[model samples]
Target: MRKPRRPDVTTLELVGGAEALELELHSYDERWASSYLEHRRRISDTPMAGKIEIQHIGSTSVPGLAAKPIIDIVVTVDDITAEEDYLDALVDAGYELRVREPRHRLVRTPARDVHVHLFEHDDPAVDDYILLRDHLRSDAEDRSLYENTKRRLLSKRWDDMNDYADAKTDVIAAIKARARAARGR
Candidate 1:
């Protein structure tokens, strides 16, 4: 089980400064799946459609899990460094490039309700995302634990949404560890 590295904030080229936004978690909604499908269709219509792998990830992907009402999509391409191959297409599809870091790039809708994460095809982070989502979907205890962790963190005032995400790293790691162990990894 390879751990995903969190890039230093200084290394990230952010198009928009981390804006102060109220963080609120919404109950699991079936519409999240529909939202992901709609976005998937939009992405599949792009030129790189057949060449990339797209998946719905994060809390929103798990049924019964509360999430921040944002659809998280992961796209794996042959080379993340070659943004020219896919970035422009995504931007043209109505997404704004938000975060660009080594081996990763993030684009989201202007409304901030949908985030698309780009990575290299072989990146372990992709597996981590799927594993965590699968685990949460199948394990009731871990699902509750994760939800509780998010709710607890929600009480704190976060200057940036990334800070709120960073706060959940520990709990997420723990859950992933258990997930890996269960798989005999």
Candidate 2:
């Protein structure tokens, strides 16, 4: 099976201009989960409620993991390419559309404290997000490794958030490899 890949930054169409990228990492906070729940409720209140699948993914979803303090949500819709199905409702709920790319769409709070990623229900990226989150939640070693890697990467300056994300690709791939192996897949 082919590994899911993030679209190159150049290929992404930014809905608004590029968002400011902050490299700060905060210690895990319990409030992050609540924040996700709040946002999830907001999304649920939208017309897209029953038609989509939502999961809290990324570092913030894992207890004890240091993260950037942003709640990352992965939402699987019936068709990611059909933005009209969900995008307008999300924007009306106050999330600014920040990115559009093949198989992916991103909306974030104006404060940039929460991000909702939309993908097709069958997208491998959705599974990858959940797998990595579950692995980090269950495995201390990989969690620490990922946290350390993030801390180390913070020392460098990145022109774009995607650049910072790209820097972590190798570590993430390695961890996901272990996760898949442990799952006997």
Candidate 3:
């Protein structure tokens, strides 16, 4: 239960812009699932995997949705704020810690393609991500709406990846609302 350590970033620029420039949405690739499986295997082989809960999320996880071809994985750990617990192990596994913010920690492969989001176990954000992913998996209408929104916004060059992600917030919130309401019924 040690506090998370700030990433060793002297060697790299803060990643938002450097990372965003690398984003280019592509038509859904069937290989994304296989890629996820491969990543899952690699991650599972790591010492931290036993304590980590992994899942494929974001548009890349949704079949038929256009995405950046980078897989988004949500990993729940005992205490996301405690990076010392797993950061070194993850780094050893070839993942570099990228963003470290309250409530979230991110790591990515050397190529900066796959994003691994770490949340504390039982964090609501984990539920939100999984809920949206599950909802999209089952609801074609919302899925289409989300995909259309992304496709429309993808052409713009964003200075920061967060800006691009922000553009989708409204749609994501709306869809999540609907999903919540449906479950309440």
| lDDT by candidate, in order shown | 0.90, 0.88, 0.81
**Residue-wise C-alpha lDDT for candidate 2, range 1-185, written one tens digit per residue:** 22333322336697766545667899999999999999999998888733798899999999999999889999888766567779899999999988888778899999889999998788899999999999999999999999999999988877788888989999999999999999999
Residue 91's lDDT in candidate 2: 92
Displacement of the residue 85 alpha carbon in candidate 3, Å: 1.3
Better of 1 and 2 by TM-score: 1
Best by TM-score: 1
TM-score of each: 0.93, 0.91, 0.87
Q: Higher-TM-score candidate among 1 and 3?
A: 1
Tell how far residue 101 is off in model 2, in angstroms: 0.1
Structure candidate 3, residue pairs in collision: 4-83
Where is model 1 poorest over a 10-residue stretch in terms of lDDT? 1-10
TM-score of 1: 0.93
Tens digit of lDDT per residue, candidate 3, span 1-185?
Answer: 24434432233235453444646778889999998999888877788733788899988898878788789998888776567777788889999888876777789998868988888777789899988998998999998999888878877888777788989999999999999998893
Per-residue CA lDDT of candidate 1, range 1-185, in tens? Answer: 23334332338887878888888889999999999999999998888733799999999999999999999999998777667789999999999999998778999999999999998788888999999999999999999999999999998889999999999999999999999999999
Which prediction has the highest lDDT against the true structure?
A: 1
For model 2, name the residue pairs that clash: none
